[model samples]
Target chain A: MFSQAKHSSGSGKTREIKEWVRKFASVPEDFAILVTELKCTEPGCPPLETIVALLGSENRKYQQKVHLSIEQIGEIDAKKISEQLQRQLENKEESVERHNEH
Target chain B: MSTSNNKVPVTVLTGFLGSGKTTLLNRILTENHGKRIAVIENEFGEIGIDNALVVSAEEEIFEMNNGCICCTVRGDLIRILGNLMKRRDKFDYILVETTGLADPAPVAQTFFVDDEIQDALELDGIVTLVDTKHVLMHLDSSSECKEQVAFADVILLNKTDLVSEAEIDQLEIRIRSMNAMAKIYRTKDAAIDMESILNIKGFDLEHALAVKPTFLQPDYPFEWAGVFEIDNSHLKITLSEGPDPSMSVSLLNIGEASAEDVTALLDQAVKTFSDKNISLSPGGSIDSTGKLYKLELAQTGSKTFYVKPKKAGKYVLFTQHKPEEFSMTIERNEIEIDAIFSTNYEASHTHDSEVSSVGITSPGDLDEKKFNEWLSKLLREQGTDIFRMKGVLSLAGKSERFVFQGVHMLFDGRPDKPWADEERSNQIVFIGRNLNRKMLVEGFQSCLKKNRQLSIR
Candidate 1:
């Protein structure tokens, strides 16, 4: 249910990420299932970046949703992650090209 | 806890072949002068102990049971020890001599595991014998050589009469770097005063003073040459370095081959070490000191062979065990490179600090950031002389304490625990490795009593 604009806040994003990172570090065991069984429910969910980050924090804990960059998502091996990121990047490129056309 | 009376001391005698182990044993039994001692010998073959010294033979735990305290403690080293302890009036000390190939950890484990034996016996020392002449050769070819030396408390450099003076000095120096605790003794005919050799407790002996066989100067300066070659498609890589500072190198070959392929090659190699003819050293007589040895791994699948001789001498990593798959040579002050493609693992992360926890407090007003930078540098420097680094640090204004553990540059994970007391200072211990002990102490002291709220990040 999270929006991309809301997740893209400057300092707000930093605080959100820090709070999540601390939570993830404190209760790492909760993140294990999400990392191992990652899937996209909506047609457009953030790419595999969240899964990779979760895998990297196997030593920590997590309690909230995670947003990730394209490069981070590309590093993941999940088919769902790859497909979602490919579609998202393509859509972004199409919008930029449309703006150029106008 | 039950306190038992009269704890018997168990002394372990170990070394590679021709290192004069049996000679030392004979001397101990026949010449600890008049000390009533019980001897336990573990042999690799069926030939048994030299027929000349069997005093009284009985039921052995393994195969051979000759007279002179020779019984295989197969399932029963403890049972035998207990039986001997029952007759304690007959002996003053117990010396268990393991096969040159046998690992002393198991024998040492025996004393720690058994309840009755644990109460009755104390581990005195592990005395390792080294054939001064052949030790370099063993170190060059065998992987087990360094592990043998690593566990030694008293190193007897036997056969001093055979090797040249230069070789003897080189051998002594090589042993020192591997083990700083073992007292080095130079002997021919394996002769030493029985009293001084036996009943000596040898744990926690500092290795700095033992012997500097390789890197004589305190600086421990040396260069390494890595060479990789392919013969008929099998890969072989060799790394050469100094005999001083008793360095041991580990070589790992990551390849795309299958584990089954590597396992087959390793089996062949193990059989080669056990073979009587093609194998230069006797089975189990292999000792690695200040020489070059090789281990090979033809990667099968993703995982590969991870065998490195325990010692830091010369080593070559190969994919096959055949002679054509390997060849090596060594000399003083020069590392020979005769193979072909190799490169160093480029360090991805460099440590940030040159100083350590020993000095955190100085009038210079040093801070947390500076301390962390120095600690990181010590980790990145390959030649940093470190034995063990451990401590608890307080984040500038944070009440929680961060725990640190380090060995060379291999330290990570600074997990924090709640501070127990109001003490604002941190405590860390660094043992061995070339470190400025006084400067380290001062660096740690400077971190104490800081009023500023500094972020640990």
Candidate 2:
């Protein structure tokens, strides 16, 4: 009975996506992974956004948002988000290296 | 930075509602002290009600009104103090009067924690006034009252005229149990000797130790403490569980000692751990059996350390610091090493669980390089959680006592008077949240002069 209910809710999908994104993005193991659904009422604001925030070392935060609800998030969305996070991290590392070079 | 002689003494005045704080402040301000005093008051209503001497502290208090005065108002106090220093000639002393419900830790912390403030101002003492008639009720109903009492250097038990002598005696005993160090004086309408409150170096290590011999002994329960005998020439120590991610592990070479000898050494180590006058001298050198193993991340999962005894005799490994997070176990090769000596208990009562104090006292001189490295890392990772820390240390190759104190990340220390007739000891106290006592105690132990006799070669 529990197995059938679990399969219907896609319970394990979020965990798999998170793990995949975390590995792809090369996020630190200690960083907190927060998947939050943000709602906004203002015009031009995304009515619903799913925010994947990586609370990293030194209080640094890296976030990627999808203009969709948490339930609507899927593997493709995770890949996009992870790519964005990887790009941001690469940029940050390059900037830090540039700072050190001087 | 101003010289110690030129630094003006600052006194923090605190009390509960109607505790005769104003009465005491008025006395200090209006008295013929032959020195000018700048008074900063954090009052709810009109500012200058006490007397013409009251300087408006509205800007300071309003800036900090986000709720907690100690943390939020600290910046404002620093600014005000810096401004006050510009007119240093106008006043020889500074007095800050906190609200009735204020926690004096942050205010007391200001003097010890700020570099700029530490330069121009020396925290004279914290004077807490208690209304004898209503203090018991306030203490029962309010945690602030208890904290004010706990951080007091001088507690003036005012309004003794309202309560009977027996009541005053009972109140004094109760207050003493909460804080055994503070000097409690019975007074009528907050009247006391001028000499008692002024020029009292309550924060000074020498004076603090003289007043309360056990001031460094905090009543915090050890999260984990154990003694393990290592007989293997090659061994690995793994921490599978503990309060925090880091733990302080001390490896003392007992040589081919008896069980009785081991017990004696453990007792001595525990005493050294508790005594503010002593620190554990670091252990003898150990040969590495494998690649160097780092002892970090032990709090979340497991951390390991590889040990190769230079000569197999008997090595005593123990963890005596309090765990800031969870309970932990030390394992050898995945096998749980039974603690030859251990303490497993829980705290029965706490005044403020969010903020606790841990005191570590050792009797030996420290390895300056190792001590600095360990402290820098500890403060870097855990400084925000560690609100205030102060210590008097005996450093290797130095006869003068090194007295160091810090607030979070800002730290300062200097050579105090040369070790006179008194024994040179390392006495340190840390007040913070989620502090790992075992880790701290062990880290400090690791910095001790590694068996000076062995190192001499």
Q: Using lDDT as the measure, which candidate wins?
A: 2
Model 1 over residues B1-457: C-alpha lDDT tens digits? 1113355666788888777777787776665265566776664422233532222212222221111111112234544564576677776677777776765544554443223444467666778888887777676566456556655657888888898888786667666645544568898988887655666644211221122122122221112223332222222223222222122232333232344433323323333333332121111211332222332223222111122244433333332222222233422223333434322222212111221212121222235665665564444342134533445555565556555543232232343656665545554444343456545554455444444322110
Model-by-model DockQ, in order: 0.01, 0.01
Which candidate tops TM-score?
Answer: 2
Per-candidate TM-score against the hidden true structure: 0.37, 0.49
Reference-based lDDT, residue B452, model 1: 36
Off by over 4 Å in 2: A1-102, B1-4, B45-52, B59-79, B82-87, B105-119, B132-147, B161-181, B204-210, B215-358, B373-388, B420-423, B431-443, B450-457
Worst 10 residues of 1 chain A by lDDT: A93-102
Runs of candidate 1 exceeding 4 Å displacement: A1-102, B1-5, B44-75, B204-217, B220-457
Weakest 10 consecutive residues, lDDT, candidate 1 chain B?
A: B63-72
Going through the candidates in the order shown, the clash numbers are 73, 17
- Model 2 scores a TM of 0.49
